[model samples]
Target: MSLTLPASRLRTQVASIIEGTGSSPAEARQVADNLVLANLSGHDSHGIGMVPRYVDAAAEGGLKPNSGVKVVLDTGALLTLDGQRGYGQIVGVQAMELGIARAKAHGSCIMTLGQAHHLGRIGHFAEMATAQGLVSMHFVNVLSRPVVAAWGGGDGRFGTNPCCIGIPLPGAEPFLLDFATSRVAQGKMRVAYNKGEKVAPGHLIDENGAPTDDPGVVVVPQSNGLFGALMTFGEHKGYGMAVACELLGGALTGGGTWHRPADTARTVLNGMLTVLIDPAKLGTQAAFETEARAFVDWLRQSPPGAGFDEVQIAGEPERKARAARERDGIWVDDATWSEIMAAGAKVGVRITSAD
Candidate 1:
């Protein structure tokens, strides 16, 4: 069974739970809004379901409350930031703000951030840049756990590195492209496990390297002491992109790579490399908007194939999902709701009803 709650009410409940963990009301609200927005956008894997883990991390001191970020290096157009193990939603927003400021002044900026908590939805940062009428791209890598397999390999070797790019449209919602390199994110598998559901074929493999749809295979330890692994999205193509993220976001940013030893005392960390550009610097905004509109409109004219609806652009589906979810309310599955309740209980926060 599942419960549906209005987005605003859901955000309030989530914020209350986070605040009980020692986060200020403002910080809690930011994190809650970010997670709920992911749910609204139809990406439940990155939604409020993660609150349990966040609470655990905070209690264990792996994620700090009210933590601050610092600039480790600065060169005007290029910089690196250390998040000091703070909540990714907060640290990420600060990092992007700095990047946007530098880009506004210099026309372009590249920034790398390390030691951040799970950076919720990567597209959110891109959308931030888009709101400022700037173009932005982000590459992210995770450390401490390997949940994805390399191309042609059977075992887990890397995290589900994600890539995102956002392009601002003068009078329209920004065009955002974001996806995990893995066929499915590890969190998606967790969602499946929580729902007591099996995943689709080709999304995962068992400990013995046999293809399996069982989400439990990915979460539970097998007799051989290994867990199932997610596959790369497009064979070599996705594997290549994942590698690039590891190198740029992980190694280059000074965040340890998957191959490095884990820090048992700390929780997982994310490293990100973001590039922001002022489109106006390259050409007139008027010319750019005209050409962009023309191209997108032309592309939309393509006829749909069998078993398909009309053509949809990179960001159209998310926009549609957001609209529908806002009107219908967000759905939380039974298992995830139980987890959230338990997590809230740990911090003396009670959620009596969906309403």
Candidate 2:
């Protein structure tokens, strides 16, 4: 079962709960808005379903409220930032703003961030860059847990490293692409478990290293005290990208790699390496926009393949989802709602639905 709530109501409730956890009103609003926007854009795995974990992390001293970022290195076109245990949504925006500023002045910037709490959605940072009229790409690695397996290996070896790229399209909406290297992100599996649903085949491998569609297999403990592992998307191809993300986002950003000894006592953290570019510096904005529009138009003209309705671009689906969700209230599954309510109660915030 699920309930529908207006985005504004949901945001207010989320913000209240986050604020109850010691975050300032502004920081709470930022975190709430980012999570709600993920749901609006059809990425529910990265949305409000995360509230419970965030709450627990705060209680455990893993996530700090209103923490500020620390600059580690500063060059004209390159920089590094330490999040100092702050909320990722806030720190990520700060780092990206710095990147955007440098890009505006130097025509390009490479920025890396380390020791940040879950950075919500990578696409959000890309969208920030696009909103600034800059092209951006981000590689992210989670440093807390390893839920994914290598191409042919059975045990868990890496996090669901994600990559995102956004290109400003001038007159049109920006072209944004974002995806997890795993066949499915761990959060998606958690969402499935919460909803009492199973995942698609080929998304998970059981403790015995056999393919399974049961989402619980990946999260629930087995008789031997081992959990299942998520598979890499596209076999070796996705595995390769995941490895690179770990190196660039983790090692390069000064956040240790996932290969470090498992320490269940440590808090979850994320590291990201972002590259921002000003197309105007390389070529005239007019020419770039013209060429981009032409290519997209030409590509869409191709006939759709079997079982397809139309040829869609990287950012089209998200735009459509946002429009529809804005019209209809966002949906919250029963289990996720229950968890949210409990999390709210812990923080002395009551979440009521306005349906």
Highest lDDT against the true fold, candidate: 2
Report the lDDT tens digits of candidate 2 across residue range 1-355.
8899888998899999999889999999999999999999989989988898889889989999999888999997999899988999999999998999999999999999999999988999999999989999999999876889998898788899999999998678889999999988888898899889888888999888988888987766777777788998999999999999999999999976887544453356899999999988877788889999999889889999999999988888888988999889899989889999999999998776742
What TM-score would you give candidate 2 relative to the actual structure? 0.96
Instruction: List, in order, the clash count of every candidate structure.
Output: 0, 0
lDDT at position 318, candidate 1: 85
lDDT tens digits by residue: candidate 1, 1-355: 8888899998999999999889999999999999999999999999999898889889988888787779999899998999989999999999999999999989999999999988989999998999999999999998755778888898788888999999997677789999999998787888889888987898898988889999887766778777878899988999999999999888888876888432333366799999999988876778999999888888779899899888777778888999999999998888899989999999999995644
C-alpha lDDT values of all predictions = 0.88, 0.89
User: What's the distance in Å from true for residue 244, model 1?
Assistant: 0.5
- After superposition, candidate 2 runs with Cα above 4 Å error: 261-266, 284-287
Candidate 1 runs further than 4 Å off: 260-266, 284-287
**Per-candidate TM vs. native?**
0.95, 0.96
